[model samples]
Target chain A: MSDKSTLFKFDNISVTVEGKQVVNSVSLNIKRGEVHAIMGPNGSGKSSLSNALMGHPAYNITNGQAALDGVDILGMAADERSRAGLFLAFQYPLAIPGVTVANFMRTALQAHRGKDADMADFRKLFKKKMADLSIDPTFATRYLNDGFSGGEKKRIEILQLSVLDPKMAILDETDSGLDIDALKEVSKGINEYRNNNNAVLMVTHYQRLLNYVKPDFVHVMMDGRLVTSGGPELALKLEDQGYEWVEKEFGQKAEA
Target chain B: MNIVTDSKYMIPHQSPALERGPAWLREKRRASQTEFNELPLPRRGLHLWRYTDPSGFMAIPDSADETAPSENYKLVEKLELDHLKSGNLEALVTDFGGRDIKVSRSGDDVTKGLVISSLSEAANSHAELIEKHLYSLIGGSSGKFEAMNSALWNDGIFIYVPDNVEVKKPLHLLREAGVEGSIQYPRLLVVVGKNASLTIVDEYGGGSSDFRNGQSYSNAVVEIIAEQDSRLRYISLQRQASGMQSYLTHRAQAQAGASILTIPLVFGAAISKQNFGVLLDGKGADSKMYGLLFGTSRQHLDNHTLHHHRAGMTTSDIDFKVVLRDKAMSAYTGLIRIEEDAKTCEAYQENRNLLLSDSTRAQTVPELEILNEDVSCSHGATAGPIDPMQIFQLQSRGIHEADAVRMIVSGYVQSSLKLVPEDLRERISEFVAHRLEDI
Candidate 1:
């Protein structure tokens, strides 16, 4: 805590979606230059926590005090929070049928940076970023995530993360539905984007992604609550023994 | 609302405008004059006139007086002339209120059997060709407005592409209207000969800006014939001012083995009603129509499209899209018909409307008539607001809500815009952007 200050902090954040409490008073603090993973089973409220943090319309944050870099973001709009250095890589990215990737990126960048924020060279910068992610240059002209393969969609999300370069990045199941090679490529982009001035919080189901991008802390989310907290070894233990042990040892089992 | 009771716009038998053409052309005009006086005004609750009132398009006493051009028409003229000089366009024609037609041709291709001239001039030089094809597709019997234009049209445009001639660049026709209380009748006749190809951008710009106090009127008719094995791309761009009431009818016929592409990019006028139809007359002919319209403010827009398969083994497809915001209203009706003898024909039609605001209204009616069992026909109609999920996705990426909505609306019409030329595509995109500014 002395070496690295808190970049993102949420205190007792509860989310209610469609008249049902999904995330129950979840409290977490992510420090700069660190990576944290929240491992959980299918209906454990991991994605709900991430979505509520990003201000998804359907997921209402009933009670919470969320801040980014000591600035209150609970009352800010999604775009305001994004401009305030917060990024969320959606697990299922929506397809904008006729919007090209380059156009979308430029618009988003203009909103974050000033409208007159002159990139030294926009085309060259975009080309280099696409090359870094091993994505084809043709994808720049193609519609954003429209008709893209699963791997391609995930890679584009990381591409956004790298381009936006936010202070706190919450990747909601970024590793889901990705093959080993795609997962590696995505991990490479995420790792490249990580530095001492930023933080990463990954919501994931399996521990396979932890092997690629090592996390400093691991927490188990169950029944809309953070039941246990531990080190990276806890992820391996959860992978080996599954969430059954954590349910019996920590609290009651989650409803199916 | 009865046009027969409107005496100011009634055409006299000895009107000077109708007497300029040749003897045969004069006879046709005289017949159309009689038809115009006899035909009644379109009634409300009719098939295509349900949502729009016909009285807006009728000419008043002031509409007969000559007036000056809108201020923007000069700038637009210079821009088009620049396109001609830069080789972006094959030819440029400026028709001022359909009373004056000026033609400017460029490149060696135009000199070789590519005829672009005023209709009056062509009627004398190419009498047989003019008499045979003129008004054959759209004439007095088409509608009340058609008869009015046929009888009252002044000097107009006539384009003829000879056999085996291929014009690489687009031919631009700048139809400029006058200011408040001004009326114009614009006519266009294009014939593509056997195995030839041509592309035309018929752009309509200018009109009054005072809708309630001093409204202008414009009635237009277009007839196109794509001969055997020929190719034709006709792009109609309507971007007039807000205080204009415009009516237009466009029809084309595609011959055997020929293909026709019709694009109607409509984005202007206080009350605009346009009808576009194509007839597949010969076997194996194909026709496709892609249209886009964006309405803002309290504008009223009505559009209709038709694809008739008259011969066997023909194919046709129509995709018309509408985007409305504010208190704007739009009604789109598309019909696809396959004749009993037109076996193995394939026809498809789709009309989608996006309502950007809660007060905006949109109505889509897609009709299909298949008389033969061997044909394949399908029609779809959809009217809804923009998807909130799409907006959220854009907002999460740091795009503000308004910018996100603009981007989505622009993207919605991008597909149809792609089918046009680069210059027209850019112009249409700018129009779309301008309409979304106040939203």
Candidate 2:
């Protein structure tokens, strides 16, 4: 509950979907002004953890507590959670036809801010953010995520993150579908938003993203549990030795 | 006194004042009355009435005087009618009293010899032209409503465009309904000379909504003749008051190298049936018919269209869209018939419906009868609900379920509105939005 250190605390959290436990009891703390990366193999519940944090209806919180700045977010609706400064960059962005990206973004911003922003000021700020992310101006008029390439869609997610400026952002595999060039651009955008007042949870299966964003803490999740937590060296170790070494070490520890 | 009643005698006779009309015209109206009396009322057995019931309209009184215009009404406003040019004719506004009908010209290009005026006025001013064209295009035995319209119509519009003149702006006509039980018989006769061009937008909106048992009947007839190398764009927008019954009949004939475009938007009326017929009488003529209707509550809208290609090398395309919400119902039947000698013709027809609720119903039938070889023709119909995945996508972004549905419906209808002019697009969008609010 102390604001002097941790920005978000997930205590003894367990989530279930369709009677199958996906994210088991796990406790983690993300400190203010730091980047934390959760790296693991596929089906390690990384995405489930992110979705549960964002209050997605599909990911049921069986027995756990997720709080933002000491306020319980377990009972908040998705929009309410969003208004409370929670953001999620989905692994697959949905396509909404007939709704321009610019219009949708502005409406989201207004809804989150709880007031109508001046049109002139909003446009200027939006244009600046888009330029910083290297997004083309013509994208504003295009339909939301409609007919966008994989790389373009990823960049658009980053674009929204920059524009919304949420208190805490959960990027779910933003680097999964991106090429090298797109990954570099996305990393730059994410790094630019890293400040002393906000925190970020990057969920990925590889160490490529941590190489650029420079995570302050690296946690390895296996079978719905955070087996090891350490400094940046942990990410490099996992990338070099793969998940087999972690699985063996855990097996040995269990036997002992 | 037995107090006996007969449907035939229930209708009032056209005053002897029209006795001055040419003998040929008088005989035509009399013969039309006979046809109106003999033709059977549309029944549920008919394919055209599959999704709608006509029993409610059968009880309407045949007496036109019972719903005659009252003297208390005044011309609300005079719409700008100057957009019509010579050779290209537009619509006419007739007051309920059968006394005044205003006709305006939109453009200044008058070519050859053209005449545009009120029907009653034309009967007195240009009797020769009226005698030659009026009722000639509208067959006396077409249907019962056509016959009734011919016998009861008091004042209407008459347009004659000379050869080779093109009118730019669309001519607009406004028909105002006065008190309850107000019967309006609007007759329009348009004649396009050889090599002429014109565009007409006939709009009917303005009347009190408190007329529950008004038994209003709008028997309208439109006759168009397109000469060689001529083009005509005719648009009819009918938004009648609730609980009103409307029977409209429109017919057009296109000559060689002529093109005709007709678009109709029907929004109101308790039970309404519109019959539109386009005849390609000349080779190489083209016709396009487009329609959109929105029915809510217990309203019933029946639309029947016929595209007759009587000449060789003619083409026609028809597209109709309907949206039904609540307990409302809509029926659309389109027919494309090609004559034996109409070789190398092309025809296409499509009808699509969107049902917004479980109670709403829509019936669509697209028929094609081709008797000529080396011709291409196709017809299709579709009816269903909105896509659910699209809805979830919008909901995931924080938009409410209801607003998401509205956006989808708006987008579905916008496909047709894209063909309309830019100035009219926003107006139509607002109108559609307002209609959805009631749903």
Model-by-model lDDT, in order?
A: 0.89, 0.74
lDDT of 1 by residue, B360-383 (tens): 999887777789999888888888
Judged by lDDT, which candidate is best? 1
**Candidate 2: docking tier:** incorrect
Best candidate (score: TM-score): 1
Model 2, span B1-439: residue lDDT tens = 0112233342435544234355766776667666766777656676766765544443233333433333322332332332232333333344443335765443444333557678877887878878877887675576656666676566788877878776654555666554455556677888887888777766664433544544455657788878887988887777777756676788899889999988878887777888888999888999998888888888889999999999999999988889889898888999899989998999999998989999988888877788877789989999988766565444444555576677777766765665564444565778789988854
The RMSD (Cα, Å) of candidate 1 is 2.3
Q: Which portions of model 1 show Cα errors greater than 4 Å?
A: A249-256, B1-14, B60-63, B107-111
Model 1, position B434: C-alpha lDDT score: 88
